[model samples]
Target: MIISSPAKQLNSKLSSQEQEARQNGYLFAQLVRLYHTFDGRPGNEYSKLQDAIACVLDKIDQNDHPYAYTNKLVMFIEARHALRGLYLSPDQNKLLIDLRENTKRTNLNYVYLSAIDATSQFK
Candidate 1:
């Protein structure tokens, strides 16, 4: 869960945008780790599941970061797509979809999300 080093030690000179990218990269890495490690379970109380939820939420929240909204949406879509293989509970899946849909409504850009989907085949 401790994804960052001390800001003074590592990012003392980074611009706000650089710091934001660093944070987003950490959350994206967490999502990828969760995708690899989550047990194929339908339980909501699993720690990894909770971690995945947190990472997803954080990624979506980054939409409001100073960086472009489209870039953040792509990141969110990529992270969400990475979790697709996990055997999450129905409620968990609904929560994720709802989060993405809520972000979509506010960001109002399906093309960005679709772009992630379109490029996923290469991965």
Candidate 2:
């Protein structure tokens, strides 16, 4: 009996879409970390709740759906805000926006799987 490798390997080089999807996954992991940090720290609970709500509304207003390409940068900014109480500088914001714009549509399933895989690695 001979062992043969399949044409499509899990460790194969990622396509551009897969790479972007993986980055988004990593960004999401960072956001979760920020949220946990913010939650655990001693602070004004009311203010934290307010800021969390505001962040959700801001994402909705900006049409940043979780599966959409725009969500990556929105979550990035929002996570930093949650962690540091500050937004990205204008240049940084513009750079994220440009990157988001350049990413084409990706398979939602692939994105979800990639995000899950990326986040799982953190633990």
Candidate 3:
């Protein structure tokens, strides 16, 4: 038996979207690492992480690329979900919730699924 690959046009589109999607994935991974490193503790590190996330969001907001906007919104949602698992204070939780809501209000699409799951579905 033989299986055919996706069409060239589909591959091209997926490749372009994948570039931004991968960046979003990386940001979420970084947030997860930070959450692990500072679980249940409020300190400079936590503040720094929050600042970094804000900076990323600001950069995304300034970006005119549609893919960048979608990627950034997805990253924000993923990061917020990852942060929720960590033992964060009420204030921290509120911050994440606010971030999620703000990102949701953006024009970008925020469809999210595990990378592996998405890839498998495509296959």
Candidate 4:
């Protein structure tokens, strides 16, 4: 879905941190939209958190923009927590837990992969 967000228009004048926040804010908004729109069992929602992250990441990638790992990680953590009450398999839960733990480090690339891997296994 195309989101009509001003954040999509990155201003070069914005500092690195500002750009990162703008991107993170945009991604967070999308995540919230997904949660509210498809908030139920995996079968009912047809909207896996993994896909949501993927979509957000894809947008960032396509734009070839520099982003802050911390901002992205926080957004992911918030999304995961937002869906905490949803029905999830043990593996999925473990993956999220691990992702949360691993994200503490400076590198956060693995969290993306882990999120994708976890959802593929179960919702």
lDDT of 3: 0.47
Model 1 weakest 10-residue run by lDDT: 114-123
Q: Model 1: per-residue lDDT, tens digit, 13-113? A: 56765866775565455444444444555554344344534444454365443223434433444465475543445544544454344334344343344
User: What is the descending lDDT order?
Assistant: 4, 3, 1, 2
Overall lDDT per candidate, in order of appearance? 0.45, 0.43, 0.47, 0.47
Instruction: Candidate 2: list runs displaced more than 4 Å.
Output: 1-14, 45-123
Ranking by TM-score: 4, 2, 3, 1
* Alpha carbon deviation, residue 9, candidate 1 (Å): 22
For candidate 2, lDDT tens digit of each residue in 1-123?
Answer: 965456445445446548756655554544444344344445565244335434533443444543342344344444555665654455545544544454335333332323321222111
For all predicted structures, in order, the TM-scores are 0.29, 0.31, 0.31, 0.32
Error of 2 at 6 (Å): 22
Over 5-122, each residue of candidate 3 has an lDDT whose tens digit, in order, gives 6787788889987886665554454434444544555655454445544544444445443333434533553454475443455654554554455345454433332442121111
Where model 1 places Cα greater than 4 Å from the true spot, the runs are 1-14, 38-86, 89-123
State the displacement of the C-alpha of residue 93, model 2, in Å, after optimal TM-score superposition.
Answer: 17
Global CA lDDT computed for model 2: 0.43
Error of 1 at 15 (Å): 2.3
lDDT of residue 102 for candidate 4:
37
Q: What lDDT does candidate 2 reach at residue 23?
A: 58
Instruction: Name the top TM-score candidate.
Output: 4
